[model samples]
Target: MLNGGMKWMFLILGTMIGAGYASGRELWQFFGHESVLAIALFTVMFSICCYVIMKISYETQSSHYLPILERLVGKKLTGLYDLLIILYLFTTTIVMFAGGGATMEVLHFPYWIGIGVLAILVVVLFFWDINGMLSMNAIILPLLIILLLAVLLLFIKSNVNAMLFDWMKQSNWPAAFTFTALNILPLVAVLSAVGHQIKHKGEILIASIGSGVILGGLSFLYNQSLIQVAHDLLVYEIPLFAILKSYPYYMVLIMSFLLWTAIYTTAVSGVFGLTARFRDMVNLPLWIIALIIVTVMIPFTTFGFSTLVAFLYPLYGVLNLYILASILIFPVLKRYDLLS
Candidate 1:
């Protein structure tokens, strides 16, 4: 049986790797070669954020998510909190959908077919049993690790340039790294959900954060590899796959599955979160709500994937800062309140 700490670690690893590392897009922009520092910063921040979220969730255990929000921000701010979280989840869902489409295109599948199939499947899986759905991360995370390592091995064997030191000096390094943290905010939301489930709060929080440290360190190394081959990376739709293409088509299959799984997990999680939010208002059942949400959002897939990344991602950064600050300052405020 998995310990609660292990389960929490699995959740964080599954969530982090889904977008931050596996997508290849994040490391491409965030750290590139210079991403080493960004990754280090992220790991430390990630651990701290995990601790804060765990503390908050533990303190408010058995309450639904909204009441906790009301307590943290006060009733006067509840409307603002709902609006902000809704926007955040909505934007995240769009990214995941767009990313899923892009991943399909990268894997040589028809754009609509790939996106549509995954959307429907995710709806089913999420609604089939909401509580049981957490297990999806545990099941898929190991495969993502295996596939990531295989790609790394192939890149190494091909003698791909491993130095991206030149990219460390690029002007966008700071902006990119900043955006990477912004990009990962949805991850914190999901981690909080998992934290809500855990019985051993402190141990799970520490172990989950330890996983982030290990992952962020490894991601820094991988981002550098892309910088080493910057020219080739810029041209390919799926640059990581291009790197591993030197091996065999079979390798592409493995890589494609890994990439798609990453995007798919993020998409599935976001949509489920969104659907779960509206369960009380709708006259229909939970599955029906999930179905309607995914179906309605599916058409947005026709729009450009890169376009959403370019537009919504920066806006997301602004909102993320507030959430990050709130999480960070909550503890200090709590301490001060107690003293008073």
Candidate 2:
């Protein structure tokens, strides 16, 4: 049961720590100075949201996000939110693809080659179906998290004098909502598909609390590191590179590989959500569906990595607030039998 919970927790982390996030761009975009309270709020809210979503998914044994969406927004609004989720997945996956390309470009690989390599890998990943993605996350995410946290901690320790301890000026607390809302769609999309696989409610508790704590800790550390390099942010497209400037070239290269893996995992998750939703309708193999989706998304990567993230992330963050609200209120409503 503990292992199963950890597996789901890794899946959630894989879905989240994508290019924008692993690269430090997403964290900086939504959180920065005066965000101490915001990060705390996000940690609590994120855990609650995860628990609610997992509970609904487990109860319904959902095969896709639609049933979960229907329950959260009701049947009347499900269709609308369905379209929203589809679009959100489509665009965000494109951002991951672009991120893959961008990460490789840092290693002197051609941009298209990086995107093509990632797309091929994503398609091949589905040949093992859901198990492939889950296994990959289980292996990769722990290493990624360790290296990321190590770097963030090292930077914070080295630059302790630059660190701000202002806890009261938390005007950016509202960003907690937007950031959590930004992540809700993918969480629903991925977790709902695994509902039937969930054997115990304890797994949900473990995953929700575990993933929330890990992500929250990483966000705070990464945000602190970025704060010191705030002025250098404009010089680099990936803000992580700004933080990495003080490190060795080999460290940057290593992080570049990890960043690509991060992009790859999220891309796989996005394709998983999308292909699972359409597989029954198309009556095709999951890998084939993944192939078609990646093929279609490749052209959209031309929009550039940072550009796509900068534009779409905040927009979806705002639009997804409704779904986030519903998830937050779900347990209360369900407890009172208000959902009926």
Candidate 3:
């Protein structure tokens, strides 16, 4: 059995590597380019969110975030709260499809084929136990960290100039904040399923936030590398993959699988959450519920990748922000008692 610390680490890693983290689009959208400093700040905020999440998990220990929100916000507001979470999950699922499609397109595979392969993989993974899902992250986190670091470190040694912040200034701050609000919620959503299971809320909070700091720093490193390879970065639909292509042909396989694993993880989690919820509703068979969701999601998953990330993500981001603010602030008020 995985120890508590390992389990927590797995949760954080899986949550962190969600489609947004993998695709580089989440960072691209939020920080524009990827200023080391700005990404650091963004990570700080994300860490704070993680800290709060750990608090929720410590307090509840085996519950989802919505029930806590319902308590904090009341039954009516709770309804709205769950609705926003569902939307966040749905949007996340869409982005996973998009990211998977984009990665496939980069590899010279058909976009729909990528989507179908990932979607099927997600459905299969969702059948695992919740704790099993946690273990999967052990595999995922190391793979992602190693590959991502390899790319960033290679570019750094090559003396690439980081242009993440400069690129951000060219984009509007207001627009960036708008995107941040939306993107951040999905980050929160990924954690919601397991937030309550952590044993040491304080430690988990620190670790998760700390991870965000590292993520921000990495983003800046990536941005700098991208600047050096500006021509190549702009060529591939998936800029990050384009970076990996810089390596030997064999490494491309590693890079592609790394990217796909992240996308697959997100799709599985999102679909599992959706299907599990429906399974509880009206007492439907779990397989039947899963099948229903797969059918419904087939079309949305087919929507091209770049379109979902570029267009739909911002709109979704706003809704996530509103809900996050509500959830975060809900506990601060004098009217509510978490222990109650």
Candidates' C-alpha lDDT? 0.64, 0.92, 0.63
lDDT of 2 by residue, 96-189 (tens): 9999989988899999999999999999999999999999999999999999988888889899854676876888999999999999999999
Candidate 3 lDDT, 1-340, residue by residue in tens: 1356555555655655666666665656555443454555555556665666656656666345565565445677678767776776776787787788777776789988888787776666655646556667767877787788887787677663443244445433444345445645444455555655666645674566556666666666665666555566455556676566657877777778888888776676676566544554657655556566766666886666665776776777676666556545654653465433
Ranking by TM-score: 2, 1, 3
Scored by lDDT, model 3 comes in at 0.63
TM-score of 3: 0.83
Name the better of 1 and 3 by TM-score: 1
Please say which candidate is ahead in lDDT: 1 or 3.
Answer: 1
Off by over 4 Å in 3: 1-3, 71-74, 163-180, 229-234, 282-288, 327-340
Model 2 local distance difference test score: 0.92
- Would you estimate the TM-scores of all the predictions? 0.86, 0.99, 0.83
What is the Cα-based TM-score of model 1? Answer: 0.86
